[model samples]
Target chain A: MGKLKLAVGVAGALAVGVASLSALAAENIRIGLIEPLSGPIAAIGSEALDNFNHAADRVNARGGVLGGRKLEIIGLDNAMKAEKTTEQLKKAVDMGLSYVIQGVGSNHALNIIKFLDKHNKRNPGKEIVFLNHSAVTTAFTNELCSFWHFRFDANVDMKVAALVTQISRDPGVEKLYLLNQNYAYGKSFQAAANKLLKERATDVELVGDELIVPFGKVLDFTPYIAKIKASGADTVLTGNWGPDLHRFVKGAVDSGLGATFYTVYGGIPSSIGGYGDAGKKVNLKQVTEMHENQDGLPEDLRDYMKSYIEAYESTWYPDRYRWLIEQLAAAIDAAGTADPIPVAGKLEGMTFPGPLGEVKMRADDHQMQMPLVVSTLTSDVPKHLIYKGKDFGIGFKTDGVVERADTTLPTSCQMDRPG
Target chain B: MEVFAFSLFNGILYGMLLFMLASGLTLIFSMMGVLNFAHASFFMLGAYLAYQISAYVGFWPGLVVAPLIVGVIGAAVERWGLRPVHKFGHVAELLFTFGLAFVIEEVVQLIWGKVPMPYDIPASMNFAAFSWQGLDYSAYRLFMLVISVAIFAALFLFIAKTRIGLIIQAALTQPNIVSALGHDVPRIFMWTFGFGCALAGLAGVIGGNVLGTEPAMAITLGPIVFVVIVIGGLGSLWGALVAALFIGIVDNLAISYDLSFYPLFAVFGVERDVTGIMQDLVRLTTASIAPVLPYFLLVLILIVRPRGLFGTRDV
Candidate 1:
C-alpha cells in the first residue's frame, strides 16, 4: 500500500512537470507550422518544418519574442492534400495556433485561405492568422486575399511581370514562348502573362505558348521544342522548377536542341544553388518565390538567418526558404497576443524585414511584397545547372504586383477585420 | 503525318501496359464474378517489391521473382481471405477487396514512407535504342511492349491448347455441370485468380521504373484497369486486348492534338492552341475521355451487338 502511494505520487509529479512545460510553451507565442510533411511535397514540407524550428529556437534563445515570452512552434503535417489540409487547419486552430506557416504552392494555399475566411467569419473576435511562407499564387492577394493571411513569397504575377520586364530590357530577346505547368499556377500565370505582354510589349510576338505537366508527364519534350523552334521564337520562357526543371532541361539538351534563352519563373534557393557552372551556356535566368542570399537582405533578417543556420546547420538554412520561415515567425511575434485573432491584425499591412528585403503586406490586400531576384547561371557546371549563382543581379523590385480584385478579397471591409 | 505515327506508337506502348493491368482484372472478374479492387494494389506491390529486389540484385532477377512471389500471395489471399467472404455475395466480396486495397495502401505507406521510391530505369535500359525522325524514345518502353506481347501469346496458348485450359473454358460456361463432374472447381478458381494476379504483378515489375513505384500509383492505375475490363466485355480476353489498345491509342492521340475550335464561335482569336477556359475544359474532357475510351466504345458496341467483338457471352 505504501509503495502504491509512492508510485501515484511520482506519477502526479511527472504529470505536473508535463503540465508546467505545456503552460510554459503556451506562455510563449505558439505558432503553427502546418505543411504537407509526408505527402507528395514531403521533401519541401519537412525542410520547411526544420527551418521554422530553427528560427523558433533562435527567437527563444534570445529570451523569446515580445518580452522574453519564447516562441513555441507546433507542427502538423497536412500531407499536401485538400482533405488532410482542412483537417490539419482545424487541428491547428483548436490547438490555439497564433500563426500558420504554409507550403509554397497556391493550390494548397487556396484551400487554406477559403477555410480561414470561414473560420474568421464564425469567430468574430477570435481570428486565426495565416503566415504563408511559400504560397505564390497572386490570386491569394488579388481576389481571395484575406486580412488574416500574410504571404512571405512573391506571387506569380510579380515574378512573371519581373521576368517580362527583364526580358524586354534585353535587346537580344525578340520573341517569347511561355511554357507553364498544366495546373492552376500554369493557367493563372499564362493568362496573366498573355494579358500583360499584349498590353505592354506590342513589338514582341507572343509565340506558341504551351502547358505541359510540371514533372515527367512527357519524357520527350521534342514536340514542344519543335513547335517553339517553328514559331521562330529565339527565347523560351518557362515556369518549371526543381526536379521538373532539371529533367526538362536535361531532356531538351539530350535531344540535341541548341542552347536557347530560358526564363524560369519560380526557383528556390537550393534549386538555384544546384545550378552550378554549366547553366551559364543556356542563358538561364531564375526568378524565385523567395530571396536566396540572406547576406544581401536587411539586418534583422540577415541576423535571423545567421542564427537559424547556426541552430539547424545547412540542412534547414537558406537552402529551404529559411528567411520565409523567419518572416512568418516575425508576423506571429507582431501580433503581440497568442490568439490567432490578434496575430492576424499584425499580418495585414505588416511590414517586416524578410530574407529578401522588406515584406510589406498591402493594406488593400494581404499579399506581402518581396523582391523577386532574376539571376543567371554561372560556371558551377552540371551540379548546380538549375540553381547557379553567378548572374544574380539585385534585379527588379516590384511595387504593387498584386491587384486587390484578382484572388480572395472580402466583399467589403465590413465582412471581417483582423482584431 | 509524323505526329500521327508517333501518337500511334505511343498508343501501342500505352495499350500494351493497359493489357498487362487489364488482362489480370478481366481474368479475375470473369472467373470469380468478384470485382477485385485490390488487383491494382497487387500490381503496385509487384512494382515496389521489384524495385527493392532490383536495388539489390538485377532487374531481370526482380522481374522473374517478384511476379512469382505476388502470384503466391494472390493464391494465398484467395484461399485464406476471399474464399470465406465469397458466401457474402458479390457486393461483399467487392467491398472486401476495396477494404483490402485501403489496407494495402496503408501497409505500403508503413513499409515505404509516403514518397515515390527512387526506382530508375536499369542502366542497361537507360539509353535510347534509336531516334525516330528527331525524337528519342526510351528503350525500356520497347522492352515492356515485347514482354507484354509475349505474355499475351503465352496466355493465349495456355488457355487454347492445354487440357486444363479446356476444362476452365468449359467451367466458365457450365459451372454446375463442371463441378458435378468432380474436376476440383475451387482449385481452378484459385489458379485463375493466381494467374491473373501474376500477370498484374509482371506488369508492375516492368512498370515500376516507368510509372514510379509509389503507393499512389495503384490508386492512379486501378480505375483505368476497370475501364479496360468493362469496355473489353467481362468474359473475353480478345475484347480486353482490343479495348486496351484502342483506349490507349485514343488517349495518346487526344492529348497530343490541340482541341481548339474557337474559330467557329469566337471572332477575337482563332488559335489552335487551346487556352484559358477552353484549356481547362479540354483538359477535363481529355483526361476523362482518355481513361474511359474503352467504356464508351464498349457501350456503343453493346447497343449494337450484345456480345462484344470476339466475345462469345452476353457479358
Candidate 2:
C-alpha cells in the first residue's frame, strides 16, 4: 500500500507540471510592430502604429487567430535608423515575439532580416518570422528572400515602371529632368526607369538629373528649378515625397518655375488634402489605384477595407498605406498560422483582398506586382486628387505593367538556407 | 538669356530668405560664441505659433505676436538653458543646444502632431507679384523678399546706430574690454540671443505660408542654416551675408544644369540615361549640392584662407 501511494503522488506531480506548461502555452499570438516612433519619421511611424493597432483590434474582435487564440501586438520604435532597428529587433526577439510587422525603408528591414536569419539558424527550433509592411526594396522578397521574411509593398521598380510607361507616351515630354532622393530605393527607381526607358522609349531626352541628400537639408530651390527650366525639358520626374516635395514645390513656384511640369512620388495624407487641388489644377498624374486599398477592388472583396476605413477615419480609410498593413495581416491569416517560416512560404502568389484591390505576392520575387493607378491632381476636390486632371483620360498603363514572372529576385542577396 | 535672368532672379530671392535665417544664426554665434543648434527649432516654433495665431487673429497679427513670443522664449532659454551650460565650454554649450533642439522637435510634434498645417498665402498676396519672361511670379514670394530686405536694413541700422548694438559689437570684437567697460556683458548676451531668435521667428511666420507649417520643417531647414553660418565664418555678420547669397546662386545654378558635365572628365562620351545610373548621378550631384555647398565651401575656404570670406578670425 505504501509503494502504491508513492507511485500515485509522482503521477499527480507530473500531471500538475504538464497542466501548468499547457496553461502557460495556451493560445497567445504575439506579433511585433517595428517602426520609427521617436525620430523624424515619427509622424509616419505613429500613423503606421494607428493603422496596425486598428487592424489588430478588428482581427481580435473576430475571434482572434487560429481558433480563439488571442492575437497580441508588440510595438518597438526603431527611430527609422538602421543600427537602432537592429537593436530593437533584438529586443523583440528577446520579448519572444515570433512574428513581426515592420515599417518602410530597405535598410531597416535588411537589419531585421539579418538578425532573424542568424537567430533562427542558431536556435533551429524557435524560428522568428518578419512580415514587412514598410520596406519596399525588392531585396526583402527577391534574391535575399528568406523563408522567415515576407514583403507587402510594391517594390521600387514596379512603382516607377508603372508611372514611366504611362508618361513615356506623352509627346510634350520630349526632354525630362529626373530628381530622386539619394538612397538605395531612389537609386533603384532611377536605375529601373533607365533600363525600361532604354528598352522602350528611345526619343526621351535625358536632361539634368540629380539626387537630393537623404533626410535632406532645407534648401532653396532657385538654382535647381532654374536648371530645370533652362534645360528646356518639357517635364520633370522626381522621387521625393512629404515635406521635401512640399518645400520643393513651393520654392519652385516661388522661383518662377510653376509652369514646368513634374511628377513626384510618395503621396501623403496632408499633401493629398491640401495640394490635391493644386495637383488637379496642375494636372498631376499620381499612382493610386494598384495597391491594397479596398476601393481599388471588386465590391465583395472590399468589405475588409471598407469596414476598416469606415471605422478609422483618416488612418487606413481608403489609403495606400493602410492597404499595405491589411494585406500583410491577411497573408498571415492565409497561412492559417502566423509562424514566419510557414507564413512566408505561403506568401508567394498569395491573393490578398486589400483596401486597394486584389494583390498577388509573386512567387518568383515575393513582391506584390499589382496594377499601378495613375492619378492626376485636381483643385476642386477636398482630398488631394489622384486621378482628376486635364490628362485624366491617360491613366497609368495598366496593360504595359511588368508581370510577376518578369521580375527575378535580386542577384545580390545570397543567404544560407535553413535545414 | 531668359533662363539665366530667371535663375538669377530666383537665386537672389532664395538668397534673401537664407540670409534671414543665416543672419540671425551668425549674430547669435558672434555675440555668444555658441552655435545655437536650437535656432532652426525656434524658427519652426515661430511657424507653428503663427499658424495657430493666424487661425484666430489675422496673419499680420500673427506676424507680430509670433516673433515677440519667440523672443521672450529665446531670452528664457538663454537665461536658464544656455547660461548653465556656458561654464562647461562652447562645445558643451553646443551640445546642450543640440539636446534642446531634440526636445523642442519632440514637443512640437506632441503639440502639432506630424501633419502639415493648412497655412496658405494670405488673400492680400495671393495674386501674381510680377511677371517676366512669360512667367507669373507669386506676390507672396515678392512680399517675402521685401520683408527680408527690410529686416536686413533695419538690422544693419540697429547694429550701426544703437547703444545696445554698440555694446554687442564691442563684445563680438573685444569681450574682455566690453566687460571692463561695465556693460553687464551677460545681460547684453541674453538680449542679443533673444533678438536673433526674434528674427528667426519672424522668418518662420512668413516662411510657414510658403513652406507649410510642419514639425519636420526644422530638421530640413536646420543644416542649411548651419551651412550658411559656417560658410559666413563664426563672428562676422558681413561674411554671413556674402556666403548666404553665394550659396543661393550656386544651389540654383547646379540644379539647373546637366549632371553629365564633369569639370575634369568632359572627354568621355558619356551617354545620358533618362532613368539609369547616369540619370541618378545627375540627380544626386545637382540636388544635394545646395545643402552641402556651404559646408564644402567652408572646408575649402578654411584650407585656403582659414578665416572665411571677410571673416575677422578663425572659428
Candidate 3:
C-alpha cells in the first residue's frame, strides 16, 4: 500500500514537469499549414510539407523569429475538399494560431478567405491571416480580394502572359489552337490566351478552341488530336495536367499533329515520363518560376538542388513557397510581434531578394510580383541537372524570363481595412 | 479524309481493348451466373505484378508470367472464396464480390502504394509502327491490337469446338446430367472462372501502360466494362463485341467532329441565342459530351431494349 502511494506521487510529479515544459514551448508562434494532405493529389500537399519544413528549419537556424521565439508549423489535412477547409481553419483558430498557410486549389483558398473574413470580423482580438503560396487564380487578388489574404505565387494572368511571350518569340507559331479542360481554370486560361494573343501577337491566328471533360474522364485523346490536326494549327496551347496532359500530348505527338504545344504544366512531376520518344517529337513548353536546366546557376543553387533531389526524389518545383516562409518570418520580425494585423501590414508592399532575384508584394492587392520563366523540354541540360529528368533524358530549358514588371498587372481590390 | 481515317482507326483500337476486357466478363457471367465485381481489380493486380516482375526478369517474361499468376489467384479465389458463398443466392454472391473488390483495392494499395507504376512499353515496341502525315502510330498499340484479336479467336475456338466446351455448355442447362456422366461439375466451374479472370489479367498486362497502372485504374475502367457488357447483351460474346465497337466508334466520332447545338436549334425556326444558364449548355459541343456518351447509350439501350442487343436474359 505504501509503495503504491509513492508510485502515484512520482507519476503526478512527472506529469506536472511535462506540463510546465509544454508551457515553455507554448511561447513559439504556430502557423497552421492547411493543405490537401490525404487525397488523390496528396503528393502535392506532402511535397509542400517537406519544403515548408525546410523553410522553417532555415528560419529557426537563423536565431528563430520574434526575438528568439521559434516558428512552429502545424500540418492540417483538408482532404482537397473546399467544405473541409473551414473546419481546418476553425481548428487552427481553436488552438489560438493567428497565422495559416494553404495552397493547392483555388476553391480551398476561397473557402479560407470567406471563413476568415467572417471570423476576423466577429472575433476582434483573434484574427488569422492567410498566406497563400501556390493557388494562382487571379480573382483572389482582384474581385474577391481580402485584406488578410496575401498570395506568394504568380497568378493565372501572369503565367498566361509568360506563355504568350513565348508564342511571340516563335515566328513559326502562326496558327494557335486553345484546347483546355472545361473548368474555371481552363476557361480562365482560354480567356487570358484569347485576350493576350490579340494584344501581343496579332499575327498569330486563333484557329480553334475547345474544352473537354477534365482529367480521368477522357481515356483517349486521339479524336481530340484529329480535331487539332484538322484545324491546321501550328501551335496548341493547353493547361492540362495529370493523365489529361500526358495522354493529350501523347496523342498529338504520336498521330503527327505536327503542332508545338505551349502548356502550363508540361514537364512537371510524374508527367511525360511515360511519353517515351513521343516526348521528344513536339516542342513542349511550360511556364513556371524555375526549371532544372536554367542557365548560369550559382553554387548555392546547385547544391540546394542536389540535396533536395536526393532527399525527395522529386524536382523542387515550388520556389515561391520557400519565399513565402521567408517573407512571413521577415514580416513577423519587422512588426516585432506575431500579431496577424501588424504582420500583414509589414508583408504588404514588401520587397525581398528571392533566390532568382528581387520579388515584390504589391500593396494594392497583396499579390506577389515575381519573374516568370517560359522553358522548353530538351536533352541539352547541364550534366548535374541531367540526373533530374534522366528517365526521359529531357528537362526544361529556360527559353525566356518574363520580368516581374512585365508579369504584373493592375488589380481592382478595395479592401476594407480596420481603422 | 485523313481525319476520318485516323478517328476510325483509333476507335477500332479502343474497341478491341474493350472487347478483350469484356469477353472474359461475358464468359464468367454466362458460365457461373455470377458477376465478378472484382474483375477489374484482377486487371490492376496483373499490372502491378507484371511491373514488379519486369523489374527483375524483364518485360517479356513478366508479360507471360504475370497473367498466369493471376489465373492461379483467380482459381484460388473461386475454390476458397466464391465456392463457400455459392450456396447463397445471387445477391449474396454479388455482395461478396463487391466486398472483395474493396478488399483487393486496399491490399493493392497496401503493397504497391497509390501511385502509378513506371510500367511502360518495352523498348523494342516503343518505336512507331508506321508514320503517316506527321504522326507516329506506336508499334506497342499494334501489338496490343494483335494480342486482343488473338485472345478473342482462341476463346471462341476453346468454348465452341473443344470437348470440354461441349460439356460446359451442357452443364449450363443440365448440371446434374453432366455430373451423372462422371464429369466433375464444380471443377469445370472453377476452371471457367479461372480462365475468365486470366483473360482479364492478360488485358491488364497489355493495357496497363496505355491506360496507366494505378489503384484508381480499376475504378475508372470498371463502370465502362459494365456498360459494354450490358449494351452487348449480358453473357453474349458476339453482342459484347458489337456493343463495344459501337460505343468506341460513337465516342471517337463524337469527339472527332465539332458539331454544335446551334444547327439543332435552328431547325425550330424560332431562333434566339440561348442566354443565362442555358448558354453554357447550348455551347457544349459533341466533344464536351463524349465522356458520358457510353453511359448515355447504356441508359438508352436499357429503356429501349432491356434484353440488350443479343442478351438471352433481361438485365
Each model's DockQ score: 0.09, 0.45, 0.39
Off by over 4 Å in 2: A1-25, A168-176, A198-208, A231-234, A252-266, A273-281, A289-311, A315-338, A354-357, A379-417, B1-4, B85-92, B171-184, B257-290
Q: Residues A1-419, candidate 1: write the lDDT tens digits.
A: 99999999999999999999777655766667778677434656766777777766766676666566776678788776788888888888787665677865677788888888888788775567777776777767766667777666666777677666666666767778887777777777788788767755667778777776554344234455555555667677777765445444544443434435445532344343222212323456666533323235556555664555455443222322454445545655676555655555555566665445455666676665655555554443222211111232222222222222222223222224543
What does candidate 3 score in Cα RMSD to the true structure? 4.9
Summarize candidate 2's per-residue lDDT along A318-360 as a digit string, tens digits: 2434454455456567787756666666666777654334567
lDDT of 2: 0.68
Q: Chain B of model 1: TM-score?
A: 0.86
Local accuracy of candidate 2 as per-residue lDDT tens digits, B1-315: 766666677778878888887777887887778789998999989998998898798789999999999999998999998888877998998899899888888888888776676676676776776776545577877888888888878877788788887888888668789999887877888888898899889989988777667767888788777767767777677777778788887766655543434433334655444455566443344546556666787778878877777777786
Worst 10 residues of 1 chain A by lDDT: A381-390
Instruction: Report how far residue B87 has shifted in candidate 2, in Å.
Output: 4.5
Between the candidate structures 2 and 3, which one is better when assessed by TM-score? 3
Steric collisions counted per model: 27, 33, 4
Q: How much does candidate 2 score in TM-score?
A: 0.86
Can you rank all candidates by lDDT, best first?
A: 3, 2, 1
Query: What's model 3's overall lDDT?
Result: 0.81
Candidate with top DockQ is 2
- By TM-score, rank the candidates, best first: 3, 2, 1
DockQ measured for candidate 1: 0.09
